[model samples]
Target: MTRPTHLRIHQFAGLQPGPRLLVTSAVHGNEVHGTKAMAEIARQLDAGQLTLRRGTLTFVPIVNPLAHQLDRREGDRNLNRNLRPPVIAQDFEDRIARVLCPLIAQHDGILDLHSFQSAGQAFAMIGPRNNTGELEPFAQEATESALAGRLGVSRIVEGWLSTYALGLQRRQQRQSDGSRRAQLISDPHYGVGTTEYMRSTGGWAITLECGQHLDPNGPEVARLAILRTLVFLGMLDDAAVEPHRPAQPPEVLQLYDVIDREDMGDSFEHAWASFDAIKRGQQIGTRASGEAVLAPSEGRIVFPNVKSQPGTEWFYLARPSDRVLG
Candidate 1:
């Protein structure tokens, strides 16, 4: 199959109109599982095996064409970070965002498929239950949470962009230059990504981290998630797809903080994967300045990236969330 060279959406609408749902993958070029899964879905749709029953379903299998061409994480900059139309369309990602952001706004719900850098079980990232003065003020938390629960994932995480904003604030306080702080203050939507942007546009969205990048099973997860989302949104008949249930009750985690890599020599004490448990006051890594990086509280480590650039997020800390699943 030929690859896409620009932003394109494949849309299918049912005979009777209902809610519009947008499903996207490959927002990050390196994550190919979602792309493969979406391709499979497109093939089935074209073959008349899968049909939308109520509403519209749109697919954007590859969001970042330039990065996908190179098979890298990003081109010029990370497309999933700082997702807003640039005042001047300078880089390729900026121009893509101009087209992608509006397309997201048109949908009622979104299921953004993604894969992570580390080895871990698949999990869903949800927004906060309430708009707590975050950059994105959304009232669709209940709806979003419900959508997340039905995605066939056992673990759900909240507090992504808000916690990232908090980390930038902390960095600003400690550093003399305060570049991160300035960026946040200057851009109210500093940490906004696809889901956050969707929330800001008055739509509910959930990001499903299918599994580790390159995991063969990740595509299957993505495929199931797409079908599950369609069923949950009433776009497809439930009888058309098999019901999915996790082996155990789902666990919800609230990400509280993000640890930044300070220097080139910064490294984790071990090859700590995502969801690795850590105790309060335990040394997780060391800074290039020879300072020990300790956990401020007991929680599971999220996204432990050893290859992170200096001053970028090395890892995140999250604990059990008190909010009940919708």
Candidate 2:
């Protein structure tokens, strides 16, 4: 069957009225595992094998259909960035955002499924707490954090907005120092993705990174995550659907900084994989001037992009944090 040109939403309403939970996949077209998982969930729902006991479960399997059709990350722009409603739609993604932002406002919770460029264990990206700036209006800080803990992932990352802001600030500083001018700030709102946009509208959202984009296991991980989220929200009977649990305790990571590529001469010492441990003072890469870029502290690297464009984020550095949901 041929797919529609625009976004497609699949709604599974339950018998009881409760919170609305939204699940979005394929915001980045190349990350297709979530789309597969959503399709499977829809199949089970249609086949009567899966049931929603309370609340509504809505799925957007392909938010960026154009990108999916092209098998690229984006059509005209990255749909994940600057998710706020625009005064005027600028591109294909912006036009979709104009329609999507209002729909997201109606949800109480969201799970945006995605996969990263590197092969690694699944992780959940948790937005800032309720009292934190844009999230202040949403008084469900504790609830959101607790929901992330229930995701059954081995790692939970926090402080995405702050880290992103820091990266932008660093880029601006580099531009002032005679480095090649970086791309002008396109997302001044600093809203990173679907999760951030949902959170801004007083809904709790989490970005679940299933695994490497091309890995067959990615879809399975995404499927389990959706099931676990349903159980966490009490939409599915716990006895009927057992959530996936890790063999060990999950490690919490707090993002502190982002490393952006400053110049064309900047490059990595080796093909560094995501989650690779870096000891304090270890040389991670080289600058445009051939100066070794050393690790500021002991931490594991996340989202290391060896082929990242100049003046864009090459990787992120994160360390263990004591924050946990009670």
Candidate 3:
């Protein structure tokens, strides 16, 4: 069966029925690698360079076209954050979510392509490990992590939604006035992204950050990730993709907390990059009140954003995990 391409979505289905997979890119307007890679894959399919072996593969090259049109991270709001269909469609991103959320829910699995603002090696972010808790009841961690390890990246990060939930809780306690809260989406699960939303609908997903936004190697990284995932999922033939093996076993990191900027004057101790290691008691930054912000433990910093507004996450802290990847 053929579905006509619309809303920047390209669908290719095999004659034999199999798993349905979704691949999305440019959920953040400024992330171009995914879009570039998607275009290449589409071109290959059109030119008969690659063929869908046994499944339906869908690609949304520009999930947030308004943001992509402006060449910015967002047009009105971050589409990647607070990702769910809005009842009223309040903002530009909300409208995109209305269309995107259902597309995500129907897939068996997904690989959301993204690029970060900071300098860092390409890594994959998986959802939390399964527990009895209701906040994030995920039983697909093992399945997701195994797929992540084969994505040509040597690092995997989890605990993103859990860490952000803690940050939101801490922010609410410190903030007396609701002024700062108005600046962000009001959802308690504000950290729910493409992958999280997919997990909620009983589909496993992975967010593959393919390197810095403008990294010269970004497109290739994204392209390889797509191909590797298709082959690993048995949707494409292994001969269609290059053999990928990291130099060592991938390092799994558990993000424990987010450090929010308290005031406009707060700043970091140095020019920090993503995955920079921190030692206990080392001053990582200075608070607005003139006190040094010291590391609570020996770990690594992730997603250090100098331009974050007050009461928003400035950086994240993570420690090594003992997760055994399949």
lDDT of 2 by residue, 2-62 (tens): 5445778999999899879999988988888889999998999899898889999999998
What lDDT score goes with residue 243 in model 2?
60
lDDT (Cα, tens digit) per residue for candidate 1, span 235-272: 77897678877676689999999887778899899999
Q: Model 3: how far is 100 from its true place, Å?
A: 0.7
Work out candidate 2's RMSD over C-alphas: 3.1
Candidate 2: regions farther than 4 A off: 1-5, 132-138, 174-187
Q: RMSD (Cα, Å) of candidate 3?
A: 3.7
Q: Better model by TM-score, 1 or 2?
A: 1
Q: What is the model-wide C-alpha lDDT for candidate 2?
A: 0.80
Best by TM-score: 3
Give me the overall lDDT of model 1: 0.85
Give me the displacement of residue 256 in model 2, in angstroms. Answer: 0.6
Estimated TM-score for each candidate: 0.93, 0.91, 0.94
In order, what lDDT does every prediction score?
0.85, 0.80, 0.86
- Over all chains combined, what TM-score does candidate 2 have? 0.91
**Candidates sorted on TM-score, descending:** 3, 1, 2
RMSD to truth, every model:
2.8, 3.1, 3.7
